[model samples]
Target: MTVEIRVSRSPGERRVALLRDGVLAGYRVERPARPDGVGDTLRGRVVSRLPALAGGFVALPGGESGFLPESECEGRRLPPEGTILTLRVTRAAQSGKGLRISARVKQRPSGPLALLERGPDQALRWAAAHPAAPLVVDDPAELARLRAALGPRATGGAAFDDALESEADSLALPETPLPGGGRLIISPLPALTAVDVDSGGADPREANRQALPELTRQIVLRDLAGPILLDLAGLSLKARGALEPAIRSALVGDGLVQALGFGPLGLFEMKRARIHPPLHEVLADRPLARGLALLRLAAREAAAAPHRVLALSAPAPVLDAIRALPGALEEFAARAGRPLVLRDASLEEVSDA
Candidate 1:
């Protein structure tokens, strides 16, 4: 299968879409202000150990702390309180949980709490993982940075296709239409994500069968990890058991996913490794996301009417969030080659004049 990676850049976020045979297969979003520290190596001081929890907290740089599990210590003893240890971030902080770190004592170095090594950004990591796939980016600066980092491997131009962007944007929606008039309603909760399979008058078994592939695709594209409960449309206990193979087959390539069969409540249970914040969580801050979206709109308007002075009007909170982003408005104005007028108004009121 032909695979390609496309990157889209805005002032507030960078979105990466992985396409297989011209179909959107995977999607990832990265924000400039909040990075998911999944592979960072840091020198941290052990805070305390709890035998009951089988883990201890380690104070990281920048006043953040991560939990170091005993299992991740390579069967070695946990470091004592206040002892400095080399640690690698295994998972990002998400859902009210701190980061998950593991001891990398073999590369131990004496130093104050600080970042020892920065992890490769998501796009570069994706490129390294899929060497055969061509990495195409939209922004020239991003392309140059990738070229500097990957050298000859970064052989692609600014080609973030509009159709691909549209497809990726649709992934942000909670409802996904499936074949044969069926649809999947995905909702992410604090405990576990729930996927309701609505047959939409289609045959139950067929709808359930057709929903598997798209369901898995949505799961991966949304980066939905941890516990997932699927309520199949009108599937019996025996029928669900019979369809186990199909469910497992749908989630084949992703090593992090595990199919745990059907639960007592008739919900199919699955678990995925939590590495980074899910897409919903990444965009959870509604005001911030809306503010960035407004900026994107302002950029388009500015491009369309270069001579007109663009004025953005929105709620105070949204405007405040936009202003809080360092150089966001300035970058937009610089790219637009004009200053933008900001106006505060009601939440429902938004306009670019």
Candidate 2:
């Protein structure tokens, strides 16, 4: 019904268009010229922090990383050497580097976080708009010091009445599996997106052909990504007729939807009209890795048998999940009946698992 478009004037800022139901609904653009990077948080482990560039790998965090410029690296605690943390995507991922940033949240009285760590134009606008109240400060430590400053406005809650009304709505939303067995994780963005189908999870439906089209619809509506690329395997010749219209209907609030049938490699392509980074990209700080991982490595030192030892290499929080993997791995390793030893990756970090 109502469509809005936002564009920035300077370079470095992204140009975004948000669409719903095959129609234009929103637009946003980035202008490097803008100064506004306050509260953008992304969780990732520092893969390789290169002092030369001042940044490293975050598991291709957001498909890339950039220089964590000395200016942004404000504190010793801020994504210190090799810390698995929530950094901001301040710039395009480096040529061999990736988007780099120190995350902090920037907010105004209004909802919908406008800028995270650095976006000058947006910050000024937010400040001007909320003159009556104190504009949110950007200092990560200082900001964290003020917990209830915003009170009920914290992003997670809604009015009790509206919440009750939403229960049914929330329940109605489907929980479908992804191409792999893992759950389909959707945070919805306002920008275009590129997803990598690295591994699978638990659900069997993830293997279904129908899941492809459905994923497209849910993704657009949730992340608001326009010009999407679905790169999962299989589905080279499945019928689009089974799902297009539903996807079209979902875009009712956005704008035009155009998609080419699945390509030779099974990558389905589609685009929506939008102007913001799809929610997922902004939020996808960390990859979906089970804290406790199975280390079925082939080796000269195959302890007690065939495969290898199962290293419980996660921190305390994920120990439970790691502990649960042994049974599954044991079943898989049973044919050879090899002894699976649980080793820790970090010789120094001793955790519960």
Tell me, by TM-score, which candidate is best: 1
lDDT of 1 by residue, 4-104 (tens): 87876666677887888988887888876667888888999989998888889999999999999888886656778998888999999987788999995
Candidate 2 local lDDT, residue 95: 20
What's the lDDT for all of these models? 0.84, 0.38
lDDT of 2: 0.38
Clashes of each: 0, 78
Per-residue C-alpha lDDT of model 2 across residues 1-353, encoded as one tens digit per residue:
33222221111122233323324222222323322232345454455566665544444233444345544554533355555444565544312223455534331232222222343333233334443323223222223333244332222211123332233123223343454454343323334444433225433223444454545555543444446665543323454334445434443543445655455655556775433343334323221123311222221134345444443444443444434433434433442346444444454354434
Shift of residue 207 alpha carbon in model 2, Å: 10
Please list the residue runs of candidate 1 whose C-alpha ends up more than 4 Å from where it truly belongs after superposition: 105-108, 152-159, 304-307, 347-353
Residue 222 error, candidate 2, Å: 7.6
